[model samples]
Target: ALTTMAKWEGGRAVDARAAETGETPLMAAASAGQLDCCLSLLTAGADPLAVNVDGVGILALVASKVSQGKRSKVRAVVRLALLNAAPQLRVLLLHHEDCGRHISFKPHQESPERISAILAFIAKGATIGLFSAEELLVSTEFDQASKEHLIRCHSEEYISVITQLGEQVANTPVAFTPYYQGFKGLPQAKQKKAEFSDTFFSPGTMAAALRAAGGVVHAVESVLKGHSRTAFVCVRPPGHHAGVDGATAGAPSSGFSIVNNAMIGALHALEGNHGRLCKRVAVVDFDVHHGNGTEEIARAWHAKHRKAGARAASGADESDLFFASIHLADDGAASSIEFYPGTGTRDDLHHNIVNVCVPPMWIGAGAGGRGSVSA
Candidate 1:
């Protein structure tokens, strides 16, 4: 009944009283053996905890039909009945993709309130130790491996539109000065700090969404060891469009389709190990999109090295080690985007992207070695 109720879209149910007193149509129909109606009502938001005419629950109503019972017997019977009711409960817990709605208000707000509403719930979960700081940080994984973002895979056109669209759907326009604002729907202090930080893309800027205090960003060391932190560690401006470089589906050819999270994290880790590290590492991508931009970064890294090698031949004592990235991809031509000469990207490439490509299965698809570098 609940499933049927939730699935109903063309027109509402005859007794769709879910909006009134919170008593959904599913709850009303599940009282009897209207199995079809029962399935339908359970599909919608129906309360099984509802009291019957004699103050008995629907569970108790159904439980009465079971075999004979005593104290433990009655208790076990109730548990069995409840456990068997999961099909009806699951519909209420999840909402699937909206193939029907032309537009959804899913990404509607950038204000603190919408964020806070979840935080309030998460805070309760945090107090009980059910959620961690990583869960609360609200940013991408900050992997050193992903620093060398290629511009080609993630085309400039797609990136610009996505960022613009993201802002249109998620940000509020404010000055980058003193970091303060008095918008009615937003907080003054946070808006101020965010406004100011948006101007700077360094270490702790909120624009980059870097939560350096204590976060999953440190998971770069072993994100692949576990399932939860497998996503790339995010560090600011949160590179949404970064890749190895290629053309998407029907879109024109572009750069890498990934942000060099792997490259950035790996380089940072490598530099920490020794000034002179391995000159080669391979990055294999398995994402649905191509990584043209990541390839662009590798190309740039190669160019810089050729120059550095030229300088070294002249006895400048420089070895700007260069590398390569291998992208395994399906074309997403429809989603291809090009990027502007954003300094953030240049800064990333100037510092990282030196490696090779391993066999496929890097991102959680198949079994392959987690990338490594020894001094």
Candidate 2:
């Protein structure tokens, strides 16, 4: 498979390091303690001496394995390799943090059990040294996303309204109110709580939401600018449900989501392109709930840029973006809120936006019965 991929990449991709971290496969294999595979790669002309931006080498990796415990068989292989290695190969083994990020806003999930689980997972992983401390960044340092970034994917009106509402709720305790008017199945008394309010807000809610959005923007920006190889933004009050302007399907916010983090990040990436705004990008969403808001934002951007001015004479903006979504289906009538914002139907496809709804049988209790995922 490696040979096939190398052939497909014309003999350069195998040795090509990650664009952000400059890590080669040998580094990964050694870090994971695949001794025999590392030896095989060394024999196959893989650069065992190659270092990442951090200057850690394969010998240093062997030291890490020794710290864990080394077997006689591997010791023999290492001895043979060292005997034949260049003078540069005998060097210090320094283990640097990998260019991957794990970010979260624990306060936003709203469920105490979920928060506990997240904390427990982090604590347990750290206790076992699953990853180094430097790599496990707590995202409190990032500022709230600026209005310029927010307005890229949302309306000024919506932003102003949401911000004022957040401030109001932050100052006083209030019950959750429906964001949209004429929301079905609500008593007149309950509907009078407030207008355009979806979920209960508190002093911490806006701060948490801003951090969540800012974290995603930072993650995407870092990866694109070659500062990090991968980043997992574990935020809550999830954004996929909210649409381009935060008012979609008659809901002020979709689900509990007020801001579309994915869309915000996507727009930032698009705007930061080095070219004449012609670089292509893809947004692949696999949330169990469909990312309708993200879809709306992507489609709008694609349509606006599909035909460009003289600046993009290369026509790079045309067919330059794609959005794919996979999620559970809406089984009821199209008009029903049980469909929950009612967007991700099978028929909703374009040259750019692709939506696939998993069949109902493949969804819950009957999931293992028969239907396939493609269904």
Candidate 3:
């Protein structure tokens, strides 16, 4: 790839390559939204910041010319390409060595397309236009909210952490590695280090994901109020983890989820007054894991702001506030409210939890059972 790519230079096309095209393959790939090709070429020696006679550098062409919404995908491709080729990234955000690396190259704004792909997975249950945004004169998307909420919600310690990740995303995409180290914990320290070195959150690292969550809940409220019937909060950092105190090893959670988007959604589902959230709401947590953070935070929020005599208990009994999850209970027999089963199990959170204590084979006993009522 390197030997074949010796033609382009100094933001201008060389004569022999000029016959092929004024720009190189890398530049062409950007325009075509061939993110993989572009990233590969760039990593292999193509110029990300190179420009030709048309005042079009590879990044510029991608930003201005390529179609919208495909940018993130293109970027995701770009990230993959970077990771696959480079043996090591000294600074995931600042490649002090990319030939096309720019002192004045400037940062690239995230493409809506890339953001949307993440949104699709994160906000699967939300209804886009009607349920969430129909009643209001304006449609509430999380783009701006994402930017705003994160700035407000995250702690300085937390913000600093994610901010660095964002920087890594900005500078050079990290190669995707498995969550575990052969047979151990995730590469969190590396992730955290990159996040800090890169300044990910300061400019809106995890905030965008937060905004989408809050916005989605607001949409849900609109529906419950008979305003809209459906809507979706296309957001990320899918916030279902992050328990009340802080994140720990056992429970499965995104460190980002410490602030939790779903919890925000549940809060907005309720009625609020005096700039405070107040109401009874049900959080249908269908995500694979039990949404402990949402449950934890909602309970806390209720304790502080719920109306006097309005709630059944002094905020402890959340039977009225629906928080249910279709998850395998990890805490063995300790998985109960009394036990506060928020921490993750000391084992592989079961994928299929069979109540082995009492069971028969396919000759089932209840509900959709195939057998007779009596043994």
Candidate 4:
């Protein structure tokens, strides 16, 4: 393979497409599970982004083989192409065990389970030479978000309350219950019983929430500073449900959120103390339920910018932030079957806010899933 690759080093042999199928050497190697040949071809300059006659990408071809129980082979080829072939597209995947450690309702430990499963899959790929050790940048130790960072999106009072509650939960042992009645008697909980009703804290809740917020901040910094072109942050205590005052819109509780991580990361990028790292930022939320907290934050941020623009009389009407939330729409006239935190609607559309509501029982087929909606 080396001798042949050497001869085709400067030639188009590696990427030469089949006359009928339009498949390149790299695509063939990936389809046949030829890991060694795939690596050699990649090193010799095979374009992993090449598409076949059916317009199927090389990564898609590799992914299609996973159902055959060839996940290791698929990961090796995909990671090699992503990390090695495309130097300009350097990608980082960041996660930590602490992000998954949080109190949850009985028989519903989705946060920890999801994190463990994802990490296990990535670990399996790493063990099978999916990519070189140097290509994978996993940060096990990262700084926890400070109070200042948390205050960027959340109110100071809210932050103080959550921090105090987290500390109290850390020191005292609270009984686990499906309804979270165990925490109702806490002093802080009594202060805002409704807000903390749905959310529960554990000994590791503070650590996980801090890490989740901090990990996102770090990921943003790494991308903006050119250390990586993109990053995937996998942390729990999901932040979209959290708003400026813990819970926003009509949410009955914090919705299992401690800190608004996404908002914090965006604010840090746009207005961090170091300096303004970005002139414009966009947040796209894709979830079954609406990201009411993110929308609320974006709305407030835009309002602040509008006020600043008006006061300065600079006529700078353009916004520096854009937020889009695609979520399941509430069932009209079906009050009993309404979704959680149901708030997003078509009427919510603004210059910088876009709410794409997917109706219940809607099935998108083929390229129909790529349908677009005006902001």
Candidate 5:
């Protein structure tokens, strides 16, 4: 079967479906209890995740054959599909020595200690068989993102200034204006000096930031290349707050973020070297504070693609990149204090942007917050 399939133009032939039923060759083989033929089709690049006209997947079709008591035959086909479908989960972790050990700002709520606690919890879960070791791929070593990758979501000058400041923090406190002026020039030095006050930086910050951004990039590429169906990237100096120019949503600082890693990864997947691997991508951010930087970047990406006459993957007028931010909103009461960054309102929506703002005092499903998000 494998030899015959090779002569039929490979994947195109193996995945060909019936016009009336929308069943691929793999589905037909599984339905007929031809285990050998199913294996051959999978090896020839048949997609096991393909569905029929009723939207029933190949695995369900194979499992249905078990009702005929062909139990062993059904099991064989299911195992083969699972192995070929890349169903394993990939978890990307930053190296302990590389992740910044000095970014311990109390307000930011992120530190080396927090990462250690999270890792311990995940390790405990894995030990108890919450997930099998065979199904979990944990990678600690990954390439640091280059200047080009960082510049995709940030300005070259901002990148340079931040890099210099991170290095200078070793010899001088971030409070030193003269040292910062030496790198950024006198005119912009004062403004840049004040921005760093909100976010702490150390000698290890540059390395940690690069690695964090790189981990996200690697995760995106791995999923697109079919190495894994899903991936979770665990890195530090949280993104989603840093915009193209570093500060976001008129915030006084970069919102404790040095670079926008998520936007960089999204753009990388959308605009690969050979061609785009993904025509449409969505970033759904559910955080206490609004992801102003992510929203800004998504808006810009849509505008750029729209200007170039590029339509969405669904052939809609909306941009290829869709961003939805669900975050806490400030109440209109006189005594109500505004939240951090204070953006992402219902009125701030765009064609591809969804800002679902939940009031600070909102509680339970009875509240309209859930409905706003659902809509």
Candidate 6:
């Protein structure tokens, strides 16, 4: 019922308070140890600070009930509600240390530069009173994603290969694939050769990748549980280029990406890792490059379960996975948007995928035959 109300598009006001008592829906839920109900109301824009006739807020009532059986759950509800009640939406910022150390010659694309720039932007926002530092909960403490979790979104073969390559990098600091050897092979005299690709991994790369994946999963849980309405996972090496197809799907050194962080997090959400069942999930990728890996993971999982659902009437069924990508087209065709990986197109649209094909330079139509430009 709460989900239906949340999805309702009609703008009709629902009375949150009673005629005489003035208690809110949130207060009632919190008082009863109904964490889910509290979350639902919070998602629907319920004012967490709504007070009753006695002048006690919903949070106070929830705190008063913390000594009950569902102590932790009630406390979590109160914390999440407090966060939501803030004037500005609280933001959780997570990053791994290895992200900042992963330097590259790719100018603005380097890990340290990019991560530092983002931190600076956040600091600026805080300094300007846009949001308080407490609202921006920054953390580096996240468990590394386990192999069991990784296998859920990636092929066994890909996982094995990436693991081997990461081990090699740890042991020897240099490894060779069919095309080229990683950075350790390049000498100080060969500075130009090292600038060729930023995707190469070192010994610590896998740990960083796992932590990055972990941060995103944690963020998703935080948001879904009403802990925070927003979270930003800032980590590198980037994973959108590391997908489930071609030679790079599971390869640790593919496109400067080691693990598909987005897909891993999505898998966690679907699997109810945080104890919340997400029947329908959508991954919107705004990266400049197409999120082929995320697309592959979502589609393949959906198809696998869908086939099982048809055969065994009572088995695990497929959940709806919506994958949308707005990025540079891979085709050189004269057409406005020529999709690569051949998965996203108007004719080939799936119930789960929506591809918005647009030209590289054509940044939407504007007045007077002018178009806004972006890099």
Q: Give candidate 5's root-mean-square deviation (CA, Å).
A: 5.8
- Against the true structure, candidate 6 has what lDDT? 0.62
Write down the worst ten-residue block by lDDT for model 2.
93-102
Q: lDDT by residue for model 4 over 250-312, one digit each (tens)?
A: 565667777899989998888776776777888999998888888888877677767666522
On lDDT, the stronger of 2 and 4 is: 4
Candidates ranked, most accurate by TM-score first: 5, 4, 6, 2, 3, 1
Better of 3 and 5 by lDDT: 5
Best by lDDT: 4
**Tens-digit lDDT string for candidate 1 (120-189):** 6756876886633233223333322222222222345533433343344323332322221232223654
Off by over 4 Å in 2: 1-109, 112-116, 128-139, 173-198, 250-253, 273-278, 307-318, 331-337, 347-351, 362-375
Ten contiguous residues minimizing lDDT sum, candidate 5: 366-375
Residue-wise C-alpha lDDT for candidate 3, range 1-375, written one tens digit per residue: 543453346423322234434676666665676655555465455544345667654444543445677665664454344334432211111000111111111243322344445445434523542222111133433232343343322345554444554455554333212221111345655343442221112234334544555566566555454343234444443466654433434443243342566655554444332232435556666543455655455555545444443543323233345554544333333222322233322211111111111112232343121111221
User: Which one is best on TM-score?
Assistant: 5
Q: Spell out the clash pairs found in candidate 2.
A: 60-93, 179-196, 179-197, 243-293
Candidate closer to the true structure by lDDT (higher is better), 3 or 4: 4
Off by over 4 Å in 6: 1-89, 101-108, 170-195, 245-253, 273-276, 310-316, 335-348, 362-375
- List candidate 4 stretches off by more than 4 Å: 1-89, 125-135, 170-197, 310-318, 334-336, 347-351, 362-375
Cα lDDT tens digits for candidate 2, 250-314: 54346666688777777766664332222667888886666778877776766666555322433
Q: What is the TM-score of each candidate against the true structure?
A: 0.28, 0.61, 0.38, 0.66, 0.73, 0.64
Q: Number of clashing pairs, model 5?
A: 0
Q: What is the Cα-based lDDT of residue 162 in candidate 1?
A: 32
Evaluation by TM-score, superior candidate among 1 and 3: 3
Q: Which stretches of candidate 5 lie over 4 Å from their true place?
A: 1-13, 18-40, 48-81, 84-97, 100-102, 105-108, 171-198, 304-318, 331-335, 347-351, 362-375
